[model samples]
Target: MSKLDWHADRGTHPDLALLDLAPESVDIDLAAVRLYRLGRVRAEMNKRDIGAVILSDPINIRYATGTRNMQVFSMRNAPARYLLLTADKSILFEFTGCLHLAEGYETVDEVRPSSTASFVAAGADIEAREKAWAADIGNLIAALVGKGARVGLERLNAGSAIALKAEGFEIVDAQEPVEMARSIKSDEEIKCVIASLRATEAAVADMRAAIRPGITENELWSVLHQSVIARNGDYCETRLLNSGPRSNPWFQESSSHVIGENCLILLDTDVVGCHGYYSDFSRTFHSGPDKPTDDQRTLYKTALEQLHHNMDILKPGLTFREYSDKAWNIPEIYEPNRYYLSAHGCGMTGEYPYLYHHRDFADAGYDGVVEPGMTLCVESYIGATGGREGVKLEQQLLITETGTELLSLFPFEEDLM
Candidate 1:
């Protein structure tokens, strides 16, 4: 397989010496890209008749405002940050200590300090503090949205929802609008994703080189983590680094379990790389000094086949339902632990257009058309019913006018194949 050519000479940064030239001389302007994203979101909102949207999800906030501060903390604690987007204004409700960070960002129309009371503070009435927080948010909503006016809300806490309802505002699910807007990426967004994939693939190379017998799973996992951070990337979203027996059933996080000789090592890099774009892909490796057993080889071959089969069928204008109907049928032996979908859309993180298998579509999938400019991660996990281990493989791709373009370039283990 041909690898992706990363153009290091055409860097993301503009040449400083060309500052005297006209603004149009710059090839790419990230600030303009962010504005384009915000505009797309607003257009989606307008199409849905959503007068305003309250965003608490960090990714959503970043998409709307292009500000990254305390993202990890904000994900766990809802009160840490939020963004309120109205037709006429955009406001950021920031945590007490982080308000200063929001300043000078062009996307933010206003930055207001969020509530200070901790949700789990000792000796404090948690319920009362929650009510107070809700009241504050309600007041803000009341000011923007008239009484009984409909507003969009994305992942609001129960307390806040109740408060908004009591304040006479109609709440609507706003996540779909944002998700739709994010489903198809812009050129700049694709650039960021490519940058992230480059860093992640490099890290995976480091991990492959460092893998050896007797190394604990946690130690091996840290190799990828360290490589990513050392290159200015962000954190890995999940701890899906496992080996040996843990690789059979899948979904196992890294642990202290030592990798024995000739064990199967399964790894998924869910790293949020440069500029917070996510690079998600999985690979299976064989621990050295012995070759993979026949069973292991069979599992690996089957998984790789499934991954490629799914990838080969992807094309522009293919609907989710159509793709599901035509997707590769899993053999009976490997059906027990089959993943929910053959592929999922990826940008900042796994987002929309989740392409499910035929059997699972009715229960968990939605219908949508695959269009140009969308990125998807094809996935596969193959292990027999009574097998000792499984193989997990994934690839990231970009949908084009004619077919698909591979974004991930990590090679499969040729020995196992």
Candidate 2:
């Protein structure tokens, strides 16, 4: 009866759908998550004989200390803030005037004003500023772990690494230690993921509610963005919503094209959601007063089949290469347009240990074991070369001690199925 009332009779109203996904409010134990994450990083460091890890990546900073400030800006604005951690101490070089953000976090031992070395901030004095910033960090490391200790640095510039090396620290790439640590999720971290997914799927339902003929692609995609923010989620990591022909090649961002009577809308929810965990899943919908054409249904069915077959074969201890060997066979026609990864690690964001399709394995695949506590997204995109449309489907799963558990609960398009 109303514009947003598309699915009332099917009990698929956005409000009701959200209630189903999160029937009751969920509470995350922030302290537990923070401490568990910190312990994980330390354990990895110990394995590598690393005495300290210096982190500038906003994501790594959040992972290590559970404190955040202007993350999007800080991602590119190097040295906006950083974290230095040793076996016994944790220090946060917070953005100016943002010290209060980590006031009560037990994982953070000290919050000091960050010394920025960006060219934009320091101009001609950048080299000196880098030296000064490096000196300050060098002093802290010396105080905590002493000089010449092996230190890992993440997402830092080459200049900073040189400076740290000049400070008598043995610099190692921190990405490995950090990612290996993050590969496995703690129980509390899983709770944050579940909460984030509930919010994300609810946002998706609202996006679906707004879909109709003549709605511009941007208009439809905006609904998802608005709903995520409304639920206290941080942001959508990508603008990957597309309609009709744009769905065939994929990777076309949402734009101003108006939807016709029947079109395929594909979306990848790269949502960096609640508590800073990621909720990555994808689905394709049919916007219709007219039923989907035969070709559209074929694509949808093929993708669903690929997704389920791949998902069913996953379990703890499966080697990445072995998974590729057992992965669903892709038909020749769909080979050119196949999704790059059959599956990939998902946590704070799309992460390490990517599993490639069998045909592509030798070139891009690497070896690793899929262990318990890892969350992954299984992906499928089926569209024949030069076809008019495509179908994208993905499912997020958590690997448990027993087997795989489905984490994403968004329903597929039954009509298209």
Candidate 3:
């Protein structure tokens, strides 16, 4: 349905108030997005001389072929369903009775019943199942590439890996190609990102509107969940909302603690939002009947400074190390509790190219150049090791040919500033 029609019909629907405030629906070409994304993965695979890739990671499967089946369930259930992509053809091994899920998608060339080998599916017959699964994979690889070719693989169980190896295929890490392919965005993909961010921010607004002096952290967080689902977005990947002292350490999931007057609440939108794209930005709110304290304002300003400074230096061709070298210097007191990544890549989920802080780079860093069309989330957290509260801030932006374009439009709490 058109955005206006949907909104008008749901204008008074109590559960959909956030949809009414969402930006008008964007026009996205689904076929273009599917084709472009599939082509990217294929190009990367060919560049690496990979004969075939077996993708079981739900995110990778979705990225490679625009088809999703039991994403969260399939994540933990190895080889429940997977895709086999060769340079010339695309084949999906779907779970039984779910073959229809991939029908008519231009990205998929064929769909067949998956060979179930995971213990949950096979039980005591797991060994026999593994051998059978390997045979199925080997037969396909032999037809498409040949016996003993360099095959790529994503997350798989040890038994499955051994089974593939027993088939004489040299398994290589396929994530390298898949992630590299996903790092850059097409115009069509960016349209979906924009729509996803709009939906997420609308939910954020509803969450913020619901925040008051006495609401429980879980109650406040549920507002966002309701709005995102009501807008047709998928589930959030995190429960990252927290209030008052619970916000100090960061990474604490939402709880039932009641918010108090003038205390700070922090949220990270690790949402698997519209079209399976992620909306990962953070904000800290002051639940106020009272003005934010001096300590709160200080934390907010510092985090804002860190976020803006990193975003300002982003551009195509900048190496990851160079970006780290020029990042805003965090005060020593906050170092112990700082956010691990200064910035990271974003697409279907928190993805490739994790940019580490200068402090952590000597041991934990890797080098890569930023490229145009890459979407990134710059992050900041300001709280001393023993501090009572903290402020978390993040901004999602597109790294353009010349500079950066901010994608998230949620306003920082002005009162805290």
Q: Per-prediction TM-score, please? A: 0.90, 0.93, 0.94
Q: How many residue pairs clash (N, CA or C atoms closer than 3 angstroms) in each of the candidate models, in the order given?
A: 0, 0, 0
lDDT of 1 by residue, 122-173 (tens): 1357657667776777677668765576778876667667766776778899
Clashing pairs in 3: none
Q: Which ten residues in a row have the lowest lDDT in candidate 3?
A: 11-20
Q: Taking the tens digit of each residue's C-alpha lDDT, what string does model 2 give over 97-135?
A: 987776656688888998888888989988888888889
Query: Model 3 off-target regions past 4 Å?
Result: 1-25
lDDT of 1 at 393: 95
Candidate 1 residue 5 C-alpha distance from true site, Å = 32
Rank the candidate models, highest TM-score first: 3, 2, 1
* CA-lDDT, candidates in order: 0.82, 0.88, 0.89
- lDDT of candidate 3 vs native? 0.89
For model 3, how does the per-residue alpha-carbon lDDT over 3-70 read when each residue is reduced to its tens digit? Answer: 44554463323223233334433467666788899999999999999999999999999998888888
